[model samples]
Target: MESVKAQSYDVHIDELAQAALNQHIAKNDYSKTFVLVDTNTKKYCLPAFEKKFEEPIDSIFEIEPGEENKNIQTCLQVWEQLSNFDGDRKSLLINLGGGVLTDLGGFVASTFKRGIDFINIPTTLLSMVDASIGGKTGVDLGSLKNQIGVINQPQMVLIFPEFLKTLDPRQIKSGYAEMLKHGLIKDKEYWDDLRRENIFEVASSIQKSIAIKNDVVMQDPTEKGLRKILNFGHTLGHAIESYCLENYDKKTLLHGEAIAIGMIMEGFLSHKLTGLSKLCLNEIKETFLQHFEKVDFDTNDMDAILKLLKYDKKNSHGNINFVLLQSIGVALTDIKVPENLFEEAFSYYKE
Candidate 1:
């Protein structure tokens, strides 16, 4: 397995990163090892992980899939399972799944006995480039995304493009949004390349995206400063995700799906508030819409989503701050956006 060393953790990218996992597990000498998975991952990914792991995991804990299930109740279930199985502080957890599983499992392990060793084997593209890095362990609180969690680094992260083969095209495209965000925030050449090339065909592109995030995270681990830039599009994206999940009439947007829309709306805001060029803004919208299907929203739904922004974790002094783009490859964080522009941003997305 090829490894990319990041500041917080080393990401081993290969055929499920088997060699790295074997080396780490052998070296650590933990009391026990537990593997966590979701239903989808269990059916599609676990066998591959098991084959690569070679050793016996003490127990396998499987949870239901989907954003809706990432909550306090699910955490309780995992905790109970760990307790019933005699898992202790010295036990190591191997989280083998997509973002939901990694986030939930990481949070569970971080809080289990005040922190146990854990490694992430991210199976989805979104997890590979974003969630599996950064050391942000979390679970959703009700309709909100990642509302309750901690900042704890995993022992290591294993990334393998082979797992992406299990995903449907939409799932794969959903992960592409984060990759696009990486390019837009840091490298214009990367952004242009993503626009011009087939992302699925390029392995280096994934590494480059992961590297960009790793660089930013290394500079600011606590999200106290530069790290906030990583929240680009996430503020509105999360609100939309929450609102859609809570509103039965509205279709539930996947994390990347909601964020794709958020990027478009935020792109319009970027053009208006941060001097981002119209050409760049148009390009962003065109590229994203080309990849994602349009989701329907009425004026009321938009208003509700906007209102939910005040509860955003990034807000301070009752003002909803946004991470806007100064240019295609440059981002400005902690910019306070006016209320009226919310509608205008929505209008731009509509057109």
Candidate 2:
């Protein structure tokens, strides 16, 4: 099996597409195995997944796709199905899809009957890089993101870039944001290299993105120090995502798109607070503008977005702390910024 080593994790790359079933059957020799996929992923990638596993799969569970379906209700439904099938702690769950499937499936398997071994077959770039490595599994709670979850590592993370060929362009971009964030926080060379490449070409870019994430996760697996770098653009980015999902009628911004904007705004914040060079900040803004569609924010909308920031999971004692840049490759965490600055920073995108 082809594998890339991460700090505390071993990420099996595209090699798994050809070996997942046989490898598992020989290794675990479990009486039964379950494969989970959402409607879209089942239609798109399930055939190859089935072909790999010559042995009979205990069952296949298909859930409806979309962010709305990722929740407790869906988890309960999956649990009911497992119970009906006599699934036990010995059963293994192979989660095959994007971030939603991996995140939700990991959570279900971890909590089902106290816990069961689970493997991630990440078909989307986002899951391959971020979700698959972190051991963070959960579902959104109401307007909040990842409010209910656990930190249980998967037995193995199987990533197949071939599956990305079936992803929508927007889905591809959603994953690209995390890759970009990885560069922005810790690796300037990675940032420059990725900037020159076409993100849609998943095969070429997967290893680098995975390597960067692995290095970061290894430094702080429990999310204490270096791990905060991953949140560089997520502070305001998440607030924008939540606000757009809850109140807007226009095209809802995906996680990546929101972070693209967050990185720009945070670039501005970094410049103001740390004297991050104007040359670097402008380069960051222009790069995002080149790849992502500019999101227009009205004055009233900005107010709502700012209000949502206070609800961020990273807040401490009600203070709005953010991860801002010291330079392209350096990051500083927990910098408190006043509410008034949000209006000024947001105005940068109003054009």
Model 2 C-alpha lDDT versus the unseen true structure: 0.83
Which pairs clash in the backbone of model 2?
none
| Lowest-sum lDDT 10-residue window in model 2 | 13-22
Scored against the true structure, residue 5 in model 1 reaches a CA lDDT of 79
Off by over 4 Å in 2: none
Candidate 1 lDDT, 1-351, residue by residue in tens: 457777667898895477888988888878889999998999998888888886779999999998889998999999999889999989999999989989999999999988899999898888888997789888988777788999899999998788888988777787889989998888889989988878576556788888899999999988898988888889999999999999988888878888999999999999999999999999999999998988878899898998899888778889888999999889999898889999998888887
Estimate candidate 1's alpha-carbon lDDT, on a 0 to 1 scale: 0.88
Cα misplacement distance, residue 223 of candidate 2 (Å): 1.2
lDDT of each: 0.88, 0.83
lDDT per residue for candidate 2 within 191-240, as digits (tens), equals 99888888777567777777777787877888887778789889899899
Q: Against the hidden reference, what TM-scores do the models get?
A: 0.97, 0.95
The clash count of every prediction, one per candidate, is 0, 0
Candidate 2's displacement at residue 100, Å, is 1.1
